[model samples]
Target: MSDNKLWEGSTPFKEKSHLFKYRNWLADNRNIYFNSYEEIWQWSVDNIGDFWESLWDYFNIIAHSPYKSVLETTTMPDFKWFDGARLNYSEHIFRHAQLEQSAIIFGNEQGDYSELSWKDLKKKVASMATYLKSIGVTKGDCVVAFLPNVPEATISFLAVNAIGAIWSSTSPDFGTESVIDRFAQIKPKVFITVDGYFYNGKPHDKTTVANNIASALPTLEKVIVLPYLKKEDVSGFPKDFIDIHTIFKTDGGELVFEPVDFNHPIWVLYSSGTTGLPKAIVHSHGGILLEHLKYMAFHNDVHKGEHYFWYTTTGWMMWNFLQSALLMGATIVLYDGSPTYPDFYKLWAFSENVKINHFGTSAPFLVASMKNKIAPKNNCNLSSIRSISSTGAPLPYEAFEYVYKNIKSDVWLCSMAGGTDVCTAFVGGTPFYAVYPSEIQCRALGVSLYAYNDDGQPVVDDLGEMVIDKPMPSMPIYFWNDPNKERYKASYFEHFPGKWRHGDFIKINSKTNGLVIYGRSDATLNRHGIRIGTSEIYRSINKIDTIEDSLIVNLELEGGNHYMPLFVKMKPTYKLTDTVKNQINGLLKKEYSPRHVPDEIIEVTDIPYTISGKKMEAPVKKILLKMPIEKSINIDSMKNPESIDFFLQFAKQI
Candidate 1:
């Protein structure tokens, strides 16, 4: 709306855009008129039934039985989608399997690279599926995995889904306690893992951790181990552990997909678990299939034969989202180990080498690259990349500019904001929209999102809680073990009686219709009478060359006074000095407001983040408010668990 477009599309690109094709299809098939993307989006939300039904037809979703209706109810938590339909999640993924097409391309920090053809992928999945069935894994049985972003993990997931069993996984970086806390709740019948994994040029043997997890879960029938790191050294593994090679040794049979109810559980994803035990959020086969089909084919514009890559570990939901690219016939690129291992530009190099069409990563990665002044265009030929997606956290305004100026001038930088609650984005980019700095292009089609004030009324062009007034097919069908639906209700519905409160602070631009996410509403900083999103403060601090990362928290003192301290992780070459503190405070005062300055500026060794790459603000706030550290957060789920020590000491002195 400002006419400050970052990148203009070519005529050919616009003609081939999925949005353009969908608009034409709507006009032709449904006799609907949509003059613009906004009009199409409005129709999608207003006539949710027609939109979803059209999506099923457009995507040509493979199902064993037809649905009686698109949706039976429209209420939150009670919404039923694709009623009377029976399908398997893996069935649709293998529908596009071609003998010569590359299914997965995997790489790691050790310089190991491998590619799996669609033929080989199907064979491996079949073998693994037969092995799982031999071990008594049947429909509705839980199968948990502890592995990296390797091909084996992908194969196991498909195999489990093919058998109609629930599949859940976490990266091997998680400690035993964190894995047990999540997998124990699901009562997995089969456990799959690797003996070890490589991270930051070092080998981490997870044999002990796997044994501990298996020992804790009494329902586990068998443990399958892959010798990923130090293949010859399997001495520490439990006696009952079976080598993964043994399962894949037999002649593979034809793939068999067991059709289950539309609402049958496909995968169980977990909440961040920063506060307490993680919630096991369950998503369904039909729900995930329809959502991913629409998201990848339409929203992302993923086409067959294109290489789609998202840098993620198996622990995060992005891995689940990335794997869906295969369903769309896109070759998925899986990278294990560190994104910054050999250098800060490792992923960029990989993107160029593989000719990735759509490259996705976290906001912090982009911010770090910007601070380091690493220019991908200087060393890598990224001509094949059409779009770069940033998520996990809000992309700072500076980072958005860096991608356009420093990375590539021609590519579309799509910044999205969503969470593990739905395993997909609520607001993201569309090929039809213009790229605006620090703003999500639009609310995803079919998602009725609104910014609600504290009084539960929708607000325009103002910061408020992000809520969904309508039901999404991808919304968690139920929380595992939440029998009476009490936990599920308290999680999303407690804030607004029937609407789903996403708990993120956001604003919708009245003129542009673009969305900007602040930080989590629960972690918003309130000093004196003003409320500030921590992201606003971080955006200002990140401009300093010496500051690598930062987190801020506001705590109320016993005497009704408030203490707002800013914890910063500075570069090794920089020191926390009076001049440096003044620079940071000055930036906040000049860029934001004088009220945005912190009471104290402290240096920290590192910043704690969840394995999924989110700042641990709410948990840190609890610690600063005199809550026990163990009870406040799960250390094992953190990327840098030791970083909490600095905050604990600082909290004690206060």
Candidate 2:
């Protein structure tokens, strides 16, 4: 493929690029010589110890006890990073805090905005920490939250980490069973939750869910509730529930930062759990601290005093990633309510209102905006946006073009691909590289990533499994309650022994070295003995004007027969007629192959997506095969669980 340079780094950006600065530092201090980014990347991976040591010095990581070695082992799952280092993740965050700067700026879909200065944030965190300590909470205790993306959630996380406690959280929208299935595995001592929340301009009372969760988890010593919607009475809550304001009323004291070991658990993140219970993946303090320092500074080019915003909930890993911006001295912008509520232009208007320097969102949001014909350039002043990051799914080429045409032409539209597994992007954009349409700029520094064929050999210019040949600092330390390391090994290392198989179908361009992610590998569609990515079909279908969103599944019957059905959610004005079906098939045939056409075309009210905005293709395929709905997926994890009803009825008819 040709080099489709959508945006090039400006002269000012080149001067400020972290890659350039790091190169200059290397040449000045270490006497290392590198001419290009590829050389630098190769050097970083080859001399892993030196590269990480340089990062520790470059970021001035505040470690109470210095590491004896940068890496203890290079093994995949058991790789130890910065062993013997003792540091607090929250301490690094507070180090960048200045009294005048805003640590967090928060808003919701209702246009309510608030700011918390660094000093105010520290005071709130200190008060909460003191309260936790008073309640007998100590180091290594699990503090799970069922809160919204509010200031309190940020403060709770900071307090939990400050005291060396592990933090885990889910959005308030999660159902009782879904929340229990995750939190019960960890058995958190303190449960922090909200009484209610608003979405799509309507208030949703989550008191029942919280009550049920509190009842089921016996280990919860205290349930602290925040009044978010103010519609419910706290008196109706369980007797064990306590008002969060009471905790804040405590006299504030100096914040205590507990220095934990390098591999100590800092937080517990969960997998989608479509097949069964979500895996409680654990990440460490030192691993996450160093990884985010490299990711935000070098890859994202986020700098001090800049405003960084990501449209995400507390449940998503991006929320955790967004909080790390505090370590860089960048103000994090938080939004709690629906992104498209009131209008499709809400987020763009929000970007302008806060003067967002770096904006992050999913690919589906951009596609929806493009289909809705909402042009931000015509309505909003987006001059402050220097970079737009897209993740959660593979960005279609049309979406990439739409961003430049309708949003802002001079911005770096970085199409990134990674997942909750690492809590960071393996392939993303760097300021030194030019933005290529629909392609991740390059492999992240310190991530030894490669596309490997089914035989576990590396390949280029062909779709294969995305694998990490060498370990990185940010890989999950272990899964909660997964003793003997059985589940942890089965998740990634089972597929290819000693290598981290990420389970994503991807290809690296031979010419540009840029990465293009197809859909999930297990969800790839096969027709006429030829394997094809579902994203290829979605890319073609999204070009049609009538279709808003779609889902496709391929089935192999017991007999020598195969079936492929295409389900589409159409625009309000359009109908699924023969002409539209023929148009879709024709586009697939012309752009892809004759085998790419679906056997049947149908219309649906909605498409099922994970709460984090990923298509539920694997679970939907199981539903089509007459699998039990409960076993097929966790309904609470879906954005629109009602959408699954259409597939259930269709399955009965078939």
Candidate 3:
């Protein structure tokens, strides 16, 4: 692909004053080697040593000792970044504490607004830190938070990291079993939770769930509860259970920041394991800091001091990624309810009131809005949004077109896809690229991504397995319970030998320099010796407004031959009539092929989704086949798991 195709925009974003400032700084400072994004990306691949060292230097990384070397010569997984560097994750985020800039912009579905300036946020974190330290939460201890995307949650996270304690969190809606399953393994010293959460105009009390988890785990010493609703009974806490507002008296306290090594664990992220148990993926301080900085600065083009908002939860990787904007001194807008609550135009209304610059959400949400025939253009002003990122699933062409016609035509539509294993993206949107209808703009800079065929050889034109050729800085340090690394190996490397198989089936359009991700490669349908992607069908079926949402799976009949079966949830205002069904089949046949249309179309009320918002196709398939579904890794956001039964009944009848 030519450079022109990669960069087709009439206005050069690189020449923008704010973007050019970094380029000019790089050129003036001979200490930093790279002069441009292309040069830096190439150097990061060539000299892996000077590249990361320079990246740390260019970003003014606060480290105790400059590393002896950038990387070690060894196996891909074992190689380390910043071998001798020592730094604390929390200190970097608090670097601009004394400034009067904005830190957090918070609101709910009810239009309630709250703002936290940098100075106030710092003071709150400091006070919380003092309270935590007074309670004996010292270095190397775990602090788990069960809260929503409110200020208290962010403050508690910062407070824990400020005192050299590891932080982990999940949304308050997590069930008692799901909460205990993961937190019990860590044996946290303190538990931070909210009394209740308001979602879609309903209140869900989390105190009972918190008490149940606390009872199961004996090591929990303190339970700090914030009263979002009226104070509820502390079910299992001792006499020492206290309210958060009572512990922290003053907003200002001397911030005692602890310094630690680069490789010290920062966040314990969990991955949903399809087989039985979820894997606790541990990410290091420096790895997450540097990787997020690079992605925000170069790929996402996050301007400093701008308001950045991504609708996600603590259970999702985007929540972690969105928090990194604070490291860049950017104000973060956090919302904690359904985007379509009360109406489909809620998100756009919130964005208009907050004046968000960069907005991030999932493709499924947009697809639903398009099917419902709701356009934000009539309800809200989305003029301030410059970039719109869609992830958690592939962005279908119709959804892209909907955004262009209904949202803003000038915004960059970035369709990014990555998983919880790395907590980073492999393919993402770039500021210098044009928006493609159904493709990710480019491979993430510094990530050596390539498509490989079934034979383990690299392929170009056709669809193949997506794999990373080199080890990036954000690779997980270790699996929490897998000491032997056997489970880790089986998770990623077992599919292909030394290469890191990412489990995404993708096709690269060499002509346009674009990439299309199908659903997970493990779920790819193979019929008559031909493999096909499920997104290929949904992408076509979703364009019709009659279908609200849909799920496609490969079905095995009595003869062991596989066929495609589709389950669709019609729009609330419409029913699945003969005309709608025929229109869907006609569109699928005309756009895709005969094989793309499902042999069976079943109407359903809802589709099963993981806590992180990805559709749960594997478990649905198991339910269709009358097999047992392993425990849901996280069931916080699940609206209805029992809805799968209706789809199974339909499939069995067919």
Model 3 scores a TM of 0.93
The weakest ten consecutive residues by lDDT in model 2 span: 231-240
- For candidate 1, the TM-score is 0.98
> What C-alpha root-mean-square deviation, in Å, does candidate 3 show against the real structure?
2.9
Instruction: Report how far off residue 298 is in candidate 3 (Å).
Output: 0.6
Per residue, candidate 2 scores C-alpha lDDT tens digits across 4-26 of 67888987887887778988999
Better of 1 and 3 by lDDT: 1
Please provide, for model 3 over 87-174, each residue's C-alpha lDDT reduced to its tens digit, 9 standing for 90 to 100: 8878888885546778999998766789988888888889899988888999889999888888888888888888888888888767
Q: How do the residues 1-654 of candidate 1 rate in per-residue lDDT, one tens digit apiece?
A: 234678756768777987788888888888998877788889889989999999988777777899999998888889899988999889988998989779999888898899999999999999999988887889999999999999999999999999999999999999889999999999999999888899889998888888888899999999998899977667788788888888888766998999999999999999989878999999999988888888887678899899999999898999999999998788999999899988998998988888999999999999999999999999899999998998999898888889998899999788888889999999998877788778888899999999998899999888899999889999999999999889999999998999999989999987778888999999888778677988899899889998889999898778779989899889988888999899998999998899899999988999999878899998998888888777888887787899988878877888
Q: Is candidate 1 or 3 superior in TM-score? A: 1
Model 3: residue 78 alpha-carbon error in angstroms: 1.8
User: What lDDT score is found at residue 168 in candidate 3?
Assistant: 87
Alpha-carbon deviation at 538 in model 2, angstroms: 0.4
Model 2 segments beyond 4 Å from truth? 231-233
lDDT of 3 at 245: 77
Error of 2 at 474 (Å): 0.9
Per-residue error at 80 for model 2, in Å?
1.5
Clash pairs, candidate 2, are none
Clashes of each: 0, 0, 0
